[model samples]
Target: MRRFKLGLAAVLSLLLVLLAGCQAIGGVDVSKAVLGTLDVKSSMSKQTLSLQLVPADGKLKEEDRKAIEILNSLSVTIDQAILQDSKHMSMEGAVQFSGKKLPFHVAIDPKTMKLFVEGMTQPASVPLDMQELDMAFAGTKMTDETIMESYKDIFGFLLKHAPNPSSISVTPVTDTVNGESLSLQKLHIDIRGDELADLAKGFLTSLSKDQEGMKELIGRLYDTYYPIFAAYAGTSEDGKNALSKADKEKQINEAVKELTSMLNELLPDYDKNVKELLADSPELKDILSKNTVLSLDLMLDSKLKIRKQIMDLTVQLPATEDLPIKQVKVRSETEMWKINEPVTVHDVDSSKGVWDVTPGEGSPGAMLRHVDRQSELYRLLKDDLKITHKSFTLYSDEDPSILYDAGYEPVIVKGTLMVPVKYVADQLDADLKWDKATKQMTLTDDLTGSKIVLKMGSKEASIDGVAQTLSQPVQSFEGYAYVPMKFITKALGAEGYWDAKELVLTIERN
Candidate 1:
């Protein structure tokens, strides 16, 4: 049951993220145009979100209690904020829980990219690399014009397939704030019952009818959006138009291969669950296909910049013999202010002093001085980490060379490489204790005493006594434990990626 919920949540979350990504990119130009700047100040914004599970039968299960608690804790208020541009943003906000307000202030500048703790004698900052945040679109070639055009096509495709909205209305209003007269526009939108499902079906049906057309549209979007991301990755950091055609193709191909490999590895589990679900009952599919509605109320300034948005959505999930779930309702609202003015800080120059931008760790900078390109760690992939499908054996420059000396060669599993757990444990100086009776191995960081326990053939692990479900379980070969190289390394505080252009797995521990 937990797995079912998790799977559904994962699928829904992925869909939401995808939709949000498209909307965010599509709306950026509109925001910039309407606001005259990409930055807006919100001095007072309030939000509330609530969710209720109306079961077909009476009462709720214990497991459902957690969901209700989470839904109840959704009240928040942003008292003030300032951001002249993306390069500088700050906010003071609080989360309201049980009549108590937990306050927080966040200031982010691209230079420091760290959130500074305020009202303290000495300001402290967390290590966050803001510069690298834009890597999502690093390889794109999108211009304002093309981005808008793409958004139009996307929205057209969606609206054409889905049922038309039940109602949409716009009105104008005027108000004065802080001695400034403001003109605002209000928008109301509502869509009801099974409309979204029909729209989704329409989208899928369209893709089936013109797969090539869908591919072309996606390809164009990819080409436009990925260049900046690739540039941030140092793959094409030059002033040239972007990565060369060959390099771009290489990167794209590498990304596809990596994705395909990962999917293949997870496909079996997904396939089994899907088959079981379909065979057991058709009710789940019916629940998804049933009618649903969403209502939105929005306020915008004269420039068509959004100042507030409220949403109410309800899904009627018909109950079945096996599952008694009936319906779900969600409501949320957000309000903001000072939308017409540019955010500015007069106390200090944001581009100087603590706000001055700094390169991320391992990046060449004034403080770090230089990035050792020739270092063993940097050369882990025999070139830049951007290279595709290029294989280079791992070696540690540390005094003991625990990883390299372990003579652990990568093992191919599910079309991906697995590395010895001993290498990773030793690299972190985590002590490995074996319990033969339980067939479990416990890894404890010698310095921190943080423990992670793994049992052979089990996809579940325990990290610091909390259960963690793994995408892949621990396996054994020749009496040594092996795990997914990327997962194990990441657990040990390392980062890994498949370099664009190929299926090469590059793990870097810094």
Candidate 2:
């Protein structure tokens, strides 16, 4: 009986394991659950100029026939050409481009063998024969259909093969220039974001309950849906210029206002929960206040400026310790310009390594034992000369011979020398040591008792027994110390080698 019970238990355990595996592998279909509305609209327009040609005798001649054939060939070529607009909207992804339907337009006059072709902004005309005219028109129609089908295919892919029948309307209009009326065509498409969102929600709700999977689905849908919606809502290139900064700001403000109003309307019931969450997360208060930006700037200047400012900001959330609330805070100001500039010197002692400076607009002289004009430390002092604007001082407290480390090398920035710590230590023959207990790293000279200790997140340094200051604090990566490589090798009498082509650095002791 005991053996039978044990066997039955084992069988049950195996079934349980199988069931758990199934649950994990076949969790909710995230694409269906979290994806909310996707709306897209596309407009394309083309204008073409045509020149008519006819036989002087008003009848078809052999030469006329050949001219017609040439025109026909040109027409087919033009008809097959596809032109896409610069503007694009991508959401969970109904991708749409600016302008009206039929990316390219072809016009043909069979009797005259005249051909006209139009793309996004340019128009071309040629004379063609009846056969060429027919072929061109057919090719144009097929091309338009293919483009539309491609759009649909992309949208279908984003919607996870779920079909949402779209409503399309095409109208032909005429415009008169000089004495002749030209054909103008417009294609309009309307997509509903709410419908897409509803579809996504319904799909997700029907799937097995998997909160994590559902959340992931929601994120994916968000990424897919926005670009499509934005493209559809914006004006086509032919119709309007790109949105200006003021216009973008206005739109963002309006969106925020609308969101706030909605939240206000719903907050009455959820206030208690929200208040509790906020109370439990004091750090989020700062983030909620200062983290608002209308758009992410893609320009080089804007990107660099924003990145430099935000790089030092860190948020730490309380985890594994307390309340189920979100906490965010800017934990470091090390990168702040004000904080990083001109480290204060406590003593004005006229020492070889000591330096003084006025606040701005003066040259600063840095004193060192052995100056390698090619080294990073030399360049740093040179660059600082412009920033300080006033004559500053530098004291080399240690033997200058230590600068001859085999692991020291120059860092290039914009083809100029800069210093990075990781590059220096690996170049020198000495081992770089990181002490997590003290959040410090030590570069020790294997031949001498001399060592330089760098504290993470501070510009302060301790070389041998003397405390010194640095222009910049040491940076850390993955809890490891990263120092200015030049400083490490120079302090250790090591040599540094930087292979620019391969972007590798080696450090070895002399």
Candidate 3:
């Protein structure tokens, strides 16, 4: 899925560049390209992908033809599109497989990055930092120069080396969209399998030239970007600041030297390994030596911008007697446009996460309101538990004033309020340590210097070296080790109250 997204993005970027370049060179207009109605569609066809490519009157030898037959199968398409004056855009896309359809859509404010979905409480505003976003989307150092440099490397290579089709044809046409008839230009391009294979072989051959230059470039890139990458990766070598420039350079040199040495040592066996692999997989060799064809069609407007594109490709799979499936077909289409008015972004309260929960918003009993209201426990405790940032006071529904307090966030599991032992220790100024080998926890109250030990899957605990029985055993679930809220607070010199009428257990500590 990640690769598919990246490939799609590349295709769109290529189209943008092609359109922009054509406009730059000729009578085409791109004044409205800054923002407009846009639509996109894409899909893969399983039927075409599995086709057995064969010519009507040709031999089947692997090397008999310069071009081998590849699958001329699969049928996929993306046809729906609507873009109203820049403020609103709507499109539907789907992929069909095994008689099932996977569909998705996109609708949002392009200017302010406000997202609107069909089934959402409200539109979501997306915030982004320019430098960080550049690094994330472009996959390079957090600088405009580095971002553009990386883009150049990608687009330049693709523009220079991508295979040239065997033929290209253009025609004029007309189509109706949303009841409006518009003149269109259509383009068709054809490519052969042998031409694609030659392109791939040429790419590999070019890598052998300027080995020393490539090595130096790699070392320089590593030395310059490693620290930035490490910061993004959330790793640090020392407690102090990052490495000095000299230190980073030294590390990069060592790494490059090691890599070069390893590659050189393995170079002698490279040809032999390739021969052995081909010898063992004759079908792979045969497939590589075969011929295939790809056809691409594009529909454009008067401005010479693409409105839609269709690709039909065919290739032959290796002959396998055991598999009944052979021929495969694939088809896809995309459309985009510009709107008159841009979608507006509404400002919203950004306060969220840890700071969003006030003194009572996320308290132990407070969260119950958001839980399963149909539960018996919810019915009983709905009005009995008092909520506060520092504690939950039950039965009396009162708050205990404290000088210093840690907070506890409570959750309900199996109709019971489960408190994390760590949250308790944190709120009451305590230290909690775990022993993995014994599956035991040791918690000490910093205020009173009181200590207790609780073991996993055990109902018994030791406090101040004295064994004590608990109402329920300590339990571990979903990577969190927990104990009953009532027991742990009581054992730690805190107060625990139970309201039989309300069916509530509240712990208060200061």
Candidate 4:
């Protein structure tokens, strides 16, 4: 369901694209008006979320009951958010857990786009350069207006092939927001999570067939990054670049062609991939398509601004032997006020102390910098969680402060993931032993006692005593073994996604 969950998120873009200043079903021209209001100068809003679980057959397993109990005790409120534009936004919120309201203040500095946080377990302020964070993988910075305008066509193309794109309904309505009665246009969507089976396969097939659209999109996107690419060449301290502007343009074109060619090579197997995915998890389609409903409602004011928003999802698990949980209801609502009015985001007083994290071994260490050793927040992240930054590094998840950065990062060789053998073993809490005389290494999972044995310079390995073929052989450098990360993670029942741009692998524990 993780793949489905991620792909389903694309519906958000479809929501934005549908409002690209177009006519509605009732001949209403509200889409244009609403789209105009997205690029707001200043605004403030409040949001809240609540979750509830429904048991199946009035019975719940111990773990399911515990999850529901925790959900019942937890609450969160987005007190308010202020922004002077897309770049400058600040939020204050509180999470009520264990009968404690843990207040936190977060702000995005307009000047540097750095994120500042405070009031959790740490008494001092924490500042992080968000742009440098690996999670910010989007190409270049663009405002809401720029994005919606530029990608409208691409969004339309994807939605055209998705199942029941017209399921979204628009209605004229008057809604009260923040104690103000106002005329509004409501855009609402109700979709079953499983209905997306066709969408997944259809999107891949449609895109592969539409060479013109793909080429146009690729060209348009590369062109949009012209400035970003040019800036790299222009900002060299030596005042001379290895690649000139013309060379950069040529490189961009070549990259686009290469990427397009790669896709072309793979597009032919879309059907095969889809069939395999379905065959691997045949129950996935039934569980989601029949038992999950995702709904979103947007209330827009006359100026095309969304004054109120609501999203609700209900997921009902089938009577599967493994998954004991039954149903989950998640709802979120936000009401807006002070639209376009002059406002200033809340700022933190850095006079006390500020932990500014850099990109290195010490990065996540700052999260626990000012944390009280005995505090709940400290215990939660440091002890309760197997903390690891995706496409980056992992820290010790034990009590006395978690693992440190591996010093070296993971690399992708010929499409296979290779990481420091010790890092993966430690993060997965597996025991690792190297046999010098035999030129072999063995990893035994702590929980299941499963074993994965790899021999040096061999394209073969044994998982749980079962032999398997590897994409590449185990390699060692400077006394450290570089093992196939995919093999280790999968063998240990883990999952990971690698960020090629940063040369980091995110091997997540299942």
Candidate 5:
């Protein structure tokens, strides 16, 4: 039974992943506009959940007494009682006795159509009618399928009672109740309003027509809810307790005060990081604007998948002097995952792609492959693979002398190449400095103060300890310094390999 409950929990968690961002139950919208203010006020009433038992002997067993005690203790801890505008709601009631006898407490809310069980574990099934549960469980052995079907029934019951029942699922649990098997089940319910549905449909429809408007709408929606969701999820227990009562007005005020103080203290540094990210990714501004709904969908997907790749991004507008903007504030809050891989540069014709560079280990290096030049590949080689910046270079074995020594033969037909200077410096923990006045490039190792200088249009180079002669002169073009791609890279302890298709330069250290 315990294993079955655990399996059920795992299945529910997996379902949440698959169902995220899906418009389940068709066109339902549960946005803030539809739900009004989600300022739910919850209160509890004192009630002892009792259970009646009938034994095989037609008489009460002594073990039933111990079972009741266990049930009472469990009920006190797990039972959830809430008062929403005088509509009372409670969850989970159970009683247990000694000598391995146990009885479960059952309560029903006719208004909400929610069933509360004490001692049996799991929430009252949703959307499922009583008849459905009886039919599903009848003649079935205790198995994960039985528990899952039962929970689905309960979820259906809850959906029927919800104001806006759009998307719903159950959370995972494991049963560990003493003397009886029980599992705690959480029902995740999403309610949508008519307005929200219209907004979603409008947004999706606009994607094919008015892309700019879609972008703006998505940005606005993101700004509107990001902070609200962040606060709700991040709020401390004390903060929640303070907001639970109207009488604790002062407490609520204090909590808000403390929260603002914390934000003020933290926002300056946070804003700087956001600024840096935005500088590199300007499109994020539109994605995080106030009118956007796609942002919410992205966030919900991230949370369900447990990925942290995009979460560090925060968008802000440029500050002005007269306004004296000390810090950029994030008014709305939503979570995103962080992505660590190098950013890809597309559209070589665009201004951002003019450099023909790709991000390397430490800085950007020149891109060696042209992804869209189809004629060049067909004229040179017969392969049909599409090219990207990372595409491997190809070479013919007939021209082995150009890349490798005459004694060595090439076996692989494909290879890759990189800029030699950046590759070398990155591995050695060194920095590259350029002097425009003399067209001289310097490589400096900060740890050892060792330097190498190469002057443009000159075949002579100077290492820190000795002068060396280069087979090819250093070259400079368009504010970038270029050296003999093969010789300089080889001198820096990097390796160069050429295959039938391409040449590759790789850093050997760090």
Candidate 6:
């Protein structure tokens, strides 16, 4: 899952750059280029990253020394990918680390997101909704899909008033990537270290002067947040208004109008403030204008799908006797293909570790509320993860109050924690069966192939049918069965730890 997260981070960044640069650089039509990246559907990609450290006048930190020795190079390859925007994406490939290739398949879909390694019991999966989990005090009108559309509008406005792209260019070119020959368009930029300060100042100056454009963006943001504030007013904490719903709506609209008028009044001074800020920050300007170089080459297929990218960043410090560093460089190369095509991610044949709990009707808890008690997700959530809530709490005591049904919980007996059946099931793969009439319990350990049988109110149990005396009888409480922790650990070849203060027992499988 961590690997999938890293891959997803890289994908989001790459796509953001693609979208932002659509109308940014020269030699491209604004209308066509702005939508260039949106046509992408699926692809295959591989990337290599290299970082080099240069020590300087002073001795480096121990961690820095270790990094130079152990963390200099890494490579990731996505053999198959589906990029239907950022959230609906998937990839399958291997990561090169420590001279070994670790294969992985990671996917984020509208219904599910999953990560699968080569030797895992099953693919790690979760029910995913490609929408924001609005857990706000008073929920906003903004949602995942809406925010994406808003970002597109915002980026378009930004590019409209941006500095002309004399520094960036696009040219027709032919290139072979990953042994595939193709005709491509290369959008390239090479920026010197000293040019960054001027670029920043120029961009800010341009933005400050664009009153109409800035007003449009500000108005859009107001629309986004207006409903949120109004909704918050209906909640307990923020509710001060006694107005009816219709009256509240009118009042919020009036407030927005007044606030917007005040904000527009300040736009006139924005240009002045930008100038003063740049003038006041000489040290910041010096740092940006020195010791750094950034260059990028992005390739697009005939369909405007971003196909390959190469980026290099180099920084060199002007080291004195007291300086700690001299020069550092980082570079990455990525290539992609199979655009707008069907893509398949990793799947598991066995449902051992994989769980899909996206069912039921309402909120996230609806799944838990309606889950079949016999299902794997139910067992995992109720036993292993120990999640007992149907909804998230906004606020809670430092030590949360635990609620147990039928007064069912673990208790200590003879200085040993006699845990309930649900707690014993936390081994994850432990198979449990009960005979209601006889109150006989059977447990099977998958890892060790060991079996145990215990009868209620009996101190004698059997390990593989061999009778043995337990630490104590399988104590019964409030119609809930309990077994001694010491006997369970030894019988199953597991280790146990009892936290007396917490009155809980932890079992470790061998």
Least accurate 10 contiguous residues by lDDT in model 4: 395-404
The best-first sequence of candidates by lDDT reads 4, 6, 1, 3, 5, 2
- CA lDDT of each candidate? 0.52, 0.35, 0.47, 0.62, 0.35, 0.58
Q: 1-510 in candidate 3: lDDT tens per residue?
A: 333234323433343232221121122222222111122122111111222334434334453232223223222333344444233444444433333333424333333333332222233444324444544534434454454455444444333323333365567778643345778766666655434433433332333333554455665566446656666766543425667768766776676576456445434454454456456666545343334445666666775656555666555455665323333334454544442234322233223311122332234433443334553333323432222224554322233221122233344445455466876776655678999999999988554566899998898998899998866677755566667776678766677665545545567753
lDDT of 5 by residue, 104-139 (tens): 232233222333222212223233244554444333
Candidate with the greatest TM-score versus the true structure? 4
- Among all windows of 10 consecutive residues in model 5, the one with the lowest summed lDDT is 305-314
Worst 10 residues of 3 by lDDT: 40-49
Better of 1 and 4 by TM-score: 4
Number of the predicted model whose lDDT against the real structure is largest: 4
TM-score preference between candidates 1 and 3, better one: 1
Candidate 2 lDDT by residue in tens digits, 218-288: 43443344333444556332235545556655555555455345434433433354345346656434333
Report the candidate with higher lDDT, 4 versus 6.
4
Sorted by TM-score, highest first, which candidate order results?
4, 6, 1, 3, 5, 2
Candidate 1 is scored at a TM of 0.45
Cα RMSD (angstroms) for every candidate in the order listed? 16.9, 31.3, 17.7, 14.2, 29.5, 11.7
lDDT string for model 6 (1-510, tens) is 333234323422333243333353445554355454544545556676677766765678776665555444445666655565555666667765445565777777666777665544456566765543455523555665566567666666655544433357788889987789889888777665555434434444555566556556666665666556666556432356534656645655665565446435444454464345446644333333446666778787766677788988877665555544566778888887666666554443435556443444223233344455664545544554445422111111222123243223546565655666545554434577898899899987544557789999999999888998877798667777777766776765556665545544456642
- Model 1 C-alpha lDDT versus the unseen true structure: 0.52
Output the lDDT of residue 152, model 3.
Answer: 45
Count of backbone collisions within predicted model 4? 6
- lDDT-wise, the better of 3 and 4 is 4
Off by over 4 Å in 3: 1-149, 163-187, 206-227, 233-279, 289-291, 299-305, 339-510
Provide the lDDT at 100 for model 3: 34
Each prediction's TM-score versus the true structure: 0.45, 0.18, 0.38, 0.56, 0.24, 0.52
